[model samples]
Target: MAKPRIFEKPMGVRDFLPEFVSKKKWVEKQVEDCFRSWGYREVITPTLEYFDTVGKASAIEEEKLFKLLDGQGRTLVLRPDQTTPISRVVSTLMKEEPFPIRLCYHSNVFRAQEREAGRNAEFFQSGVELVGDHSPEADAEVVALAVEAMKACGVQNIQVAVGHIRLLNALLEHVVQEPEMIAKLKQSLGRRNLVEFRESVQSLNGSDKKQMVLSLLTMKGGQERLDQLAKMDGGKQVAEEVTHLKAMWHALEDWGVASRVVLDLSLVGSLDYYTGVYFEGYGSEGYYLLSGGRYDRLLEQFDRPASARGFALKTDRLVMASTQGPDHPERVALVYSRNMRYEAFQIANRMRRQGKAVSLFVKESDRSFDSLAGYDRVEEVIGDGNL
Candidate 1:
């Protein structure tokens, strides 16, 4: 194999120059402020975690994990997602803390890409986890916070699609008795392949049962869908789940975010997790901005049984779509003749105290002006007086 070029970088990673960093940071600040207002405190975890623990629990595809061996020959993985690592912290370090812990984080997660598919191997996410809450209100809180965070980021036409996994599961259990077929149907929905889901439903024997299975795809729009669910014959279990969704929706209305959220029963994006009320947030042109839901079983897997839910914002994408990037600090150039270098330092020091960014330059024989391009204003000092 040939040596890699000097400028070559690993795929699915990005380099954020100064200007780009300004925008990314701007977006972060906006969302961070929104989170802080909601009483969520930030938590951070190590970039690499034990593969057997966090890697397995992360819910990210195994093939997407970037794994390596530690010095002890133990397997480690670049954390593919933040939620699992946070769960580990809550289960271990803060296990004794009181119920309903609220934690937030801004971190970069790594996922290995087999082939470059125009997706990042590493990305930034800002999110929160609310633990030890089982009420539909908890789910609605996350959904509302997701909308507020998106709005704080200046997302246009923000819309959230909400669904209850239990409802889907109950409907499936009522229709499809075979576990294998049920898993396959859910996989199709998790992948957002409605056509595949419909095809799988058609394979079932009963026409009425097939139609009921397909309602996960068709039953969407708004509260009307919830009302329709009440009138349907989806068994007692399905009615309970539907009632839970309706309660969650009313909670969203209490938060005044109902205008921005709509029902999408087919919104199951990977049904392996989330007990109920999962949602995906979208910006202009339906760009996926964030996602979150209830995961009452995840903590139990970590040796702590607690109801929890949260969402992670795609910070990089938010930066790209942000309406305005914060402006860089105004830069001042303090150029000085060789003999008056001492005077230049004093002036630069004063400006620094005044919250100005100062760049000091000494006049040489050539007097080249190339470096002055980035300065907003310039001042000069000759041997005797200012020039």
Candidate 2:
């Protein structure tokens, strides 16, 4: 007879061992505590949702969704993002809730990332959604909360790169009338491809438009950059947007996180649903830790058109960036012979009551006590009932 084969776990999936799980839980607790302190309540949504519902509002590509068919012949997908599903819940279920509903969630999302992307197919996300408020204060509150969450995770040397989608949209609307051309321009800008962006803008109506497009590609810094943008033609056209950004800056200052903020106008978000200010947080080690922005129109797909903004922290990446290590519990190994089994149980119970982690072992096993490497101390129950 042929030997049985052991099947391996599916690719892009991971089995988190206890040590890693402990660290992840620690990070989650810190984030949840911070969210609670800020008046955001925890909410949970289904892992599987209708493809049509999620696809209508999310920017995830159809091919990248983990899709299936329900018993009723309806299409279903493992949620590729949380914000859309949460929006569906709020719009359909919590429609009557008070204005500016604050919700926070810690859940895993599924995405079929390309193999070369080196990203897991399933990863955890911790985030918040501030619904029904359109003010610049809402935007600033989300950003500030993101910063606090990062600090809570023990991440240092953080920088929050703030940008306005309206700034880029305004510039594109001014230079390119054709939707196709504008999309190409945005694609180039999103990739930070200056040469390609410059080429795309070369067909613009005048040198002024081309220069403005080229300038925005590199226009990122502190208050000076904002001042310079305000003086430009593109910036002047969207003066109201600039004012909103300024108000957000002031709010960040009021939160005492202004020193960590930088104005990076070229920082366009990947999601098409974003309608206004968007920001991404980075750590000193060159990892993108968090990203979010205002998506005012997303809820309209569910018939609840309200202004909302929020951000999600990539928990997997955050574990890599966190300075804290996994907690090591002090463990005691309780060894026993068959005759001393009851005595061993009593000793273990006593140890447990004393708050010690006890690992019970039988001396009859082929393995020796030394084989248990992680235990800090090993006690053997002898025939005399003495440890």
Top-TM-score structure, candidate number: 1
TM-score of 2: 0.92
Write one digit per residue (lDDT tens) for candidate 2, span 32-104.
Answer: 9999999999999999998888865677778889999999999999989989999998998898887889999
Error of 1 at 367 (Å): 3.3
**Top-lDDT candidate index:** 1
For candidate 2, the clash count comes to 0
Lowest lDDT sum, 10 consecutive residues, model 2, at 2-11
lDDT of each: 0.87, 0.85
Clash counts for all predictions: 1, 0
Per-candidate TM equals 0.94, 0.92
Q: Clashing residue pairs, candidate 2?
A: none
